[model samples]
Target: MSRGRGWAADDGSAVAEFVMVNGLLVILTLSVIQLGLVLFIRNTVVDAAAEGARFGALADNSATDGIARSVDLITTALGPGYATNVTASTGSYLGHPALTITVQTPLPLIGLIGLDNGLEVSGHAAIESLN
Candidate 1:
């Protein structure tokens, strides 16, 4: 059995094609996963901030309490590192008194770690009163 002259020139091309395709697929998959991770982290942080603001807006609670609550939520969900930069303040939102909780966290470039303070989110809740 003999092969054609053109077949010899095309030998080993499959291996090269497979490598390139595989590389591209791997990169695409990793990119999708990373995007999902970023979204998850952002949502978690946002929820924590909102919950903290609501908690702090309670008549018996204060801005400091809100900050503590936000910190605790983020710490438990992600880790202590992400919770370090949380802050809370009392102010007016939509013309009504409110509490705001702001969270600044890493941008998560490569698996749960990235540029520090690259992302920021805030949550606000109306302040409760007994009057």
Candidate 2:
């Protein structure tokens, strides 16, 4: 009789443990995926900024051109939302004239939605002079 009672008490414990473990595994998997997405977004934005700076540093290009390039690249790669805060200016890098492109974007916390202007990156390229 006592053995029968013990067996009954243990009957549903396996299902409960399974549910808890499965929940933990699912959360872990999602966390990893979200981290990967954040990294990918950061790298893409950085590359776009650098490319825009290089483009604007060309002898024939202007700072506004660099801003436009960055906006276009970001919009195409991510979305219009991520490209909204791009800016460009003339600056000096390593004691030489340069074009700088700055990009501010959201740091995604949950599925591409996150804090506004939480992530920022800049790119610089030496200005080309036709001397």
TM-scores for all candidates: the values are 0.92, 0.91
Per-candidate Cα lDDT values, in order, are 0.94, 0.93
Clashing pairs in 1: none
Q: Model 2, range 45-102, lDDT digits (tens) per residue? A: 9999999999999999898889999999999999999999998888778999889999
Displacement of residue 117 (Cα, Å) in model 2 is: 0.7
The segments of candidate 1 whose C-alpha lies over 4 angstroms from its true place after superposition are 1-8
Model 1: which ten-residue window has the lowest total lDDT? 2-11
Model 2 residue-pair collision total: 0
lDDT against true structure, model 1? 0.94
Q: What is the lDDT of residue 60 in candidate 2?
A: 96
